[model samples]
Target: MEFAADVFPGGPSDPSVLTQYADHVAGSVWTGEERLELKLSSHGKKVHSLGRSVPAIEGLVIGTRLSPLIACSVDTGDQGLLSSFVERWHRETSSFHLPVGDVMITLDDVSSLLHLPMVGDLHVFQPLHMDDAVQMLVDLLMVSAEAARAETGQCRGLYVRLQWVRDIYKRRCHAGHWTAASREYLLHLLGCTLFANKSATNVHVVFLEALRDLRYVVHGISYTT
Candidate 1:
C-alpha cells in the first residue's frame, strides 16, 4: 500500500525531517481509544502502543524563499489511502497560510508548544531520514511566521527560524541576506529557487535565491486586522 505515488520517492530529496515524520503522523496505527497516537519506543525496535501496525508516512517540506512546496512520499500499494493522506497534508498547510482563525492541535486539554532549541533551532526530538530533517525545520518557521503576524498571537518563535536560515546561507558563502528576519528570509529563498536545478562554484542556486526573496517579498507583511 504505497502512500502517495505522486511524491516521487527520490530517497531523501529535500533533506528534511518533515519527510521522516510522515510515517508517524499519517500511518494507520490507532491508539487505545486515544485520538492522537503518542509515540512509544520498545524492545529494541519502534512498536505501536498496543501492537497495532500501520503503514509508514513520510514527507519533506522545504521553503523556497518565495513559495511553499510540500512533498510527501509513502511506501505502500494503496493509492486511495495515499491520496487521502496527501489531501489532508495539503489542507493543513494551506489553512496555516491563510489569514484567519486556526484550529490548533489539542490532546484532551493539553496542546503542543513551539519547541525551540537553546541556540534557537527548532529541535527535532525524534529520528528521521536525513532529507526529512531539513524540511521539518523549515516548515516550522513558516508555521511560526504565520502565528506571529496572525492578529494578536504569542508565537513569535518563527523569527528564530528565519534567522537560522539566513545564518546557514551566509556561512555557506552565499551573499549575506537582509537583516529584517521575515523580509530577509524571503529574499534569499526566492534567490535559491531560480537556480534550483543548477549551481555555480558550490552554492545551491535554487535554495539560495529562494531564501533571498522570501526575506522581503513574502506576503502582505501585516494582515491588516
Candidate 2:
C-alpha cells in the first residue's frame, strides 16, 4: 500500500496536496449525497428589528463599544459555499486547506469585518452556580428571583432563552427604565450576534458579567473565537 512521493508530496503538512485529494474524493468518488446544512437562526434579524424601534441609548451603547454592531445586519449568505469551506477546515493546522493555499482567520480579520474593537482585555467567561446565576439574572435583567430561577433551570444554569430577553426588552426599552433597558439590549445584542450558538434559542448567562459595568464593555473586553 505504498504511495509514491508525488502523490502525497509533503505528507500531512502539505495543504495543497490534501486539498486536491479532498476535492477528488468529494467531487467524484464519494458516494454520499447529503450535504452539510447550517443551523444559523434568524435571531440577528430579530435583534436588528427590535433595535429599530427601541429608544436610543447612545451613552450606554457607546460605552459598551457595541454601537457599530447595532447598525449591522446578519446575512447568512450562500450556505453551500459556507459548508464547503467548513469541510475544508483542518483543526490541526487551524486553517482552511484550499486550492489557493492555507488560509487562517485572524483577529484583525474579525475586527475589520465586524467593525469591532480589537484592543481590549480578553473576554473570558466563568461558569456560575445555579443560585448565583439566578441572582445575577434578577439583578441585571430586573426579573423576579422566581422567574430567574425557572429560566436558569431550563438551560441548566448556563443559558436563558433569547425570546425571553426580547420580551423583557419590549416591556422596558423606554426612557422610564433606561438603565435596565440598556442591560437587556446589550445581552440581546451579544446573544444574537457575537456569541450566538447553534441552538439559536438561548444565550449564555455568563455574558451578564459584561453588562454589570457598561463602562468596561468596550475597552475592557475583547472576544476571541
Candidate 3:
C-alpha cells in the first residue's frame, strides 16, 4: 500500500507545536515545577476509556485534580527528545528487534504520519490535552496495526496496539513521573481497553512485562497476569 505522500502536511510543524505533541504523546508534560502534586495511591479515581471503567494508575493529581497526559513545549530542532521517545516506544513494542515485514518504523516518523492527519492543523498552536493525545495515539495505532496486518498477518495488530500503550505506561514509571496509584490506573486502563476492544481475538500469550509478569484471564484467554 502506498503511504500518504505528505504525512504531515499542514501539521504541527512549528517547534513549539512539535514539542507539545511529542511531550503529550510521551507523557512528559507532568515533569516540570508547574507539575501537579498528585496524591496517588494503588486505589484512586476511576477513568473511563474504550467502554470500561479504569483507575487512573500512575497518574499525577492534586487533591481532586488529576491530569492523565499533558503537553509541553520543546525547543526547536530537539531531535533528542524525539529520538528518546522513539527508542522507548520501539523497545516496548518489539519493533527494535522484530521486523514487521519490510517496514522499519520509527516513532518520530510514525507519529508524524499517524498523528497529524487526524488532528489536522487545528491543534497547531495549542498543545493537545491528555485525552486528545491518547485518543489520537489509539486511533493511529489501530490504523497502523491494520496496515501492518495487511502487510503481515503473521502478528496480531491488537498485540501491537496493546504493547504500544503498555510501553507508554512503563516509560512513565521509569521516568518517575507516575505514582503507584498512577501506574495502577494506567495499567488498568490499558488492560481494560485490551479486554474490551480486542476481546474477540484469541490471545494465548499476552505479556505484561511492566506488571511484574503477572497474568489474567478474560473470555478463556490469558493477558497481563
Best by TM-score: 2
The per-residue C-alpha lDDT of model 3 at residue 35 equals 34
lDDT of 1 at 36: 41
Prediction 1 global C-alpha lDDT = 0.28
TM per prediction: 0.16, 0.78, 0.20
On lDDT, the candidate that comes out on top is 2
- lDDT at 88 for candidate 1? 39
Backbone clashes (count) for model 3: 15
Candidate 1 shows a clash count of 60
lDDT for 214 (candidate 2): 80
**Candidate 1, residues 73-177: lDDT per residue as tens digits?**
112556565544442342323322122443333332111121211121222223344234334334532324333343112222221232344454343323321
lDDT of 3: 0.32
Model 3 lDDT tens row, 1-225 = 122225432223443324333333323432332533322121112222222212343123221121221111112455565444443342233433223432346445533542311112211123444344333333432224344343223333323343434444455445554443343333444343323332322221122222321111111222221
Model 2, 1-225: lDDT tens digits are 123445453234455434555443243314465654565466657676676434456577776668677666667778777777766676555678678887998889878988888886686677778778888888988889998978878877578998888888767864357777888888888888788887877998888887887877776555675
Error of 3 at 154 (Å): 11
TM-score, prediction 2? 0.78
